[model samples]
Target: VGAALAAAPGADEAYGGFVYIMWGEKANCLSQVAHRNLETLLSAAPNARYRFFLYGPAQAAGYRIADGLSKVQFQRYAKRGYDVHMRLVNARWGPYAPATGVRDAWADQTNVGEDWPGEDRPGEAWWYAHRSRFPYEDKKHSKLKSVQPHPRDAFFNAVVHMYLTGGVHTDLTVAFSGLEKLTTGAEAQYAMYGDGCERRDAAYDDIITEFDGWDVSLPMALYFPDAGHPALKCVLDKYDQAVQNLSGLDAMERYCLTPQAPNGFPFYHEEEPHEGDYEAPPPAGMAQLRPGHGACARYLLETCKAQTELQDPAAPALKAMTVEWMGCDAGFHWDQWRFPYAASKPFRELAAPEGFDAAGVTGVWTGAALHGKRWEEPPEEHFISKEIYRAHPATRWDHPALKAGLLARQWQRENAIADVEDADRVFAEDPDFPKCAAALPACTSFFHDFSELKDMQYYREDAPKSPRNAAAARCSPTLIIPGAEKGASTFLYSLLAEHPQMISPLKGAGFKETGAYLAGFDRPGQLWDKTSHFPLIRENEPFLTGDATVINMVDKGAAKRVVRDNPNPKVIFSLRNPTDRLWSAYRFTFNVYYKTHLPDLSYANIVNDSVDGFGQCMQRQLSGAAAAAAGAAGEDAGDAEIE
Candidate 1:
């Protein structure tokens, strides 16, 4: 029993206490800025132990960063005679004790299809877990059940981690500037940052600003003196009940759940009676809205709000002390900087900053914790650099002028703006020029219609309709290589280009294929005529042009389109094994799209990792395709065996 107890976390005093940070599903790898901030935090807080709960399929690089930090953190504190432990923990392990067999096993289940109209089919434990992590409701049905897009998983995890280990709980973006002060018992039992939950009414505390709403503090940076706090337990109990209530509903019922308004807005479901058989007014009393009954209702009313006014015995011993300081000020948070308007001076001053950092008055926001849907493409690195942060396009004096200047500079980099004429040409050509000009001072005067001027300055010879080519007759490609991607299409194309008769477009003009037809822009635009691609070809030369668009093989209509465009066209397709092609495509996509973003993730790890979402997707596609084929063959798809 002693050995077992000793093995458990929070059992030893060597590592002063735990500081838990939830790095949500989106962040597969730590950015350069996050790494620097974390290193600084560790250096500042030598005594406190840190554990980052990383969610999702994090790349190998992220683990390397964690592993590297863990190895070196001990050395930093050894000289000072303090125990240091910094490591990463996969959030999949969950906070539940082994005694309670409530593990998330939904991923392991096969053929768990979409929620259709059906009988009551209670969700698995894993479904509940998934819903908690991603809590946005379907909102199709009239009955509203869910809260707005709040990070329920992170919130619940914060409470659980603090309740169990008893220390500071923070979002990954939160820096530990004042960790030493807070951890040394200088602060109250419950300390929180109040940037998010600012109360405007006099009934609450008058800290006047545009933000007037609920008095609920965010879990972005929460600190508890000790483990087993009744308030924390109350939160966990309420949250668990909410999760259970969701699991009771079948897939259809879950799908029909309407999302509630933002935290401060009037929750219509609570204000008005829900339609149909459930017309009872929501219970106002805390006890009346206990675990099994209206856990969600309770959550909206009491649990999510600041518990200061709660007269219940479990209410905190003292009102949680609001941590208001320079670095701790929520206004300088990284999230606000994502949008141009939000980061503007007007919004920054009015919105009332809702982010906190421990780095003091540096005012440089770094790190992203709330994942949402940015996994497909990582967040833009506009403000990551100190230079870019300082030159923030939105927050500048005379926002339009600054944006114009930045836009002009960007344009100048791409196309030379040597003089007024060059500037006019570049500005006219720039895609962003129209939008930027619309917002600029005297926008109409800044841009001019140069069409007439260009037309007047004509040459002696009549201008050709398209770019110069071997002959006017040689407009479209005589050869079309409909592709099998990852089937050595480029290699084949290069070999074919070596022949004197077989000419290919220059690298600037569709090196592999113009992709005009592939992109569905089969019109007389920039990428339409073959003459535009073979500009340097000698007039009257007998040369055959070809387009090797690898994706063309996948599109059914590409052949018809190619044949219609060219009179005497020769088509070729280099087919590869489907499995090998898919694997190669996966690797290529990972390398081209995700490798730089998630450096540590190995393709092998991605293939081996839990959650075969891709496989499930493929299964659905194949099933649908089989059903379609059966239908085309005039057979009943219901009885047809999909092999």
Candidate 2:
């Protein structure tokens, strides 16, 4: 402590001034040392003045001395023009000290009693004596006066009153809903006091305070009884009454009702008068309503007709059919303007009703836009050269006698050659065609030159008995494509559709049933029976066998049928990384499902609930089903089986 004091920036200065003495254990021992030190300094340096300040435990020193030696010393310092001050450290001393006549020495030096009246006294005396009364109390006439509202509380009440009368209903509701009961008596008086509307408002404020901690959803439901909750109905009734009363009365009377607006008044309304001689018509080109048009034309027409019937009892038939046709035309044009894919021709042709001029435009030429830019009329020029044409002997001038007869023949040969050359160029440029050609094996001899030529006659007689022929007969097989929601199942299904034999069922059929059945499979025979009526492909077996029939059942059409039968069947079980899956699950649960049932539940609540064990339960169910399926597959099966 001494080191800290010595290290203090201004502690070394000789100009003596008032010193504050902190109280407590340290102060009790330090005060004496401080006083003695000050005296020694005074003896050494006569010009330096000294003062004593006793606070906390040090203040108790003066009182502890029955003869009051410390008190006498303090007075002596004061007499010698050295300041002496003492202060009480205990916060609770105020109330008891006044009644006991045990004045705090610090209080006397600061004139706190004169400044704040009885505030410096103990809580028992100061607070109990001036506490607010519930009914009313007269300050001047009554011996025991009630406490007045604290300034902060009075200001808050005034603001609340302004908001209520000013027609800020939402603000009033929010303010009242948040207020909690005050713990201290002084705080309570300051929070609820005074006469007129402010006092009346206090009554309602107390009721709100009582219910502040209740669940908001319960009251919300009651306030909206159509929602079928009694509590909500009661709250709504009170709210409605408050609004209605406020709306019917004058501002001053409304204020008197509850220091807030009376019932039936809306929070805010249009300020301008509607009933005036200078009423203006709507602005030019503004329609009374949006015209029935665009993709929603049919829907809009029906809606308009229904609205007309509601507004006018004597309304004629709306002619919705005729208007709808016109609306369809408008929709056609609208779609063409926005998205030209609907039209047979390109969008550029539609946009340019007049002839298109590609040269005038800055971009590269397109076939649709080059109609007028490339030629004023058809060129009619032949693509073939005369020299090339003459090369054909049938049409050469040297064979003039047969020229007329061979002219057609010559033209056909030239055209055929051009077509072959064009085809060859296209094949070379195409990436996939070359790759396919390279993958297929080349045959050196035709069927007539085969080593089994001697058995050809028998083969022809028994062609139906061949395995290849039977497989080809079973080509029109059903396909089953099971998939999880938003997974690659759809994409795979689309790709598989290109195969003529594969047939997929329409979407919306349950795909998960296949997975569920597969998970329960105890043997291959069970799987075969489950898919028996469907189509499948057999390995190295004839199509007529039972195995082949079972394999055929798993084709595209059967998959579709399975999905149709089971809406929630598990098809493919796919999962993302844990963090990503959790995020997706959270979004699906809260944004999709929870919004429908519990809209007011916060994100924090959802996350906390998930972390508290619900999420683990869901994950376990999914994994458990997968594990069961794997166990049923057999001991030799790999952990990551796809089919």
Candidate 1, residues 390-433, lDDT tens digits: the string is 12211111223333443454343443222223445646678777
Clashes within 3 Å, all models in order: 6, 48
Native-vs-model 1 lDDT?
0.39
Model 2, runs deviating above 4 Å = 1-502, 505-513, 522-525, 532-592, 599-609, 612-643
- Backbone clashes in model 1, listed as residue pairs: 59-601, 60-600, 60-601, 61-600, 330-355, 331-353
Worst 10 residues of 2 by lDDT: 216-225
* Displacement of the residue 67 alpha carbon in candidate 2, Å: 99
Task: Give the root-mean-square deviation of each candidate in angstroms.
Answer: 22.5, 40.8
**Model 1, stretches more than 4 Å misplaced?**
1-15, 24-33, 57-92, 97-150, 186-219, 243-322, 325-338, 346-643
TM-score (all chains, Cα) for each model: 0.34, 0.16
lDDT tens digits by residue: candidate 2, 340-434: 33434431232321443322211111111111111111122311112111111110112222221122222323332221223344455665644
lDDT of each: 0.39, 0.25
